[model samples]
Target: MKIQNKRLFASILFVLISVLCVAQGPPYPGGGPPGPPGFPIDGGILMGVGVALFYGVKKILGNK
Candidate 1:
């Protein structure tokens, strides 16, 4: 068979397989979906600010 025909057949098979995969809806923990995930920038934000401040001070002082 030609390469083009092979590629076309592959594409069709892939699409059909993907459709079968999602045929059943997703399962929920309870009766409905859960709430949004939490934002985890609690201590990381302070660390990032400290690093930026240290870098800025070093640049201002012309440190090597």
Candidate 2:
């Protein structure tokens, strides 16, 4: 096929695909689907950061 023919075919195919994509209907009345529950880190993240900072400080202040 010629280059113009190929481009026309591609444009038609793209339009059809976009129509399907945009036809997903309206959103759920109840504010869409629910996401995963929140993860409880408590003090684990802070503890890790604290330990890393302590190690870094110790290394920086150490004598050669």
**TM-scores for candidates 1 onward, in order:** 0.41, 0.42
Q: How high a TM-score does candidate 2 get? A: 0.42
Please give the TM-score that candidate 1 achieves against the real structure: 0.41
**Which ranges of candidate 2 are over 4 A from the true structure?**
26-64
List where candidate 1 sits over 4 angstroms from the true fold: 29-32, 40-64
**Number of the top candidate by TM-score?**
2
Looking at model 1, the pairs that clash are none
Number of clashing pairs, model 2? 0
lDDT of 2: 0.89
For candidate 1, give the lDDT of residue 17.
96
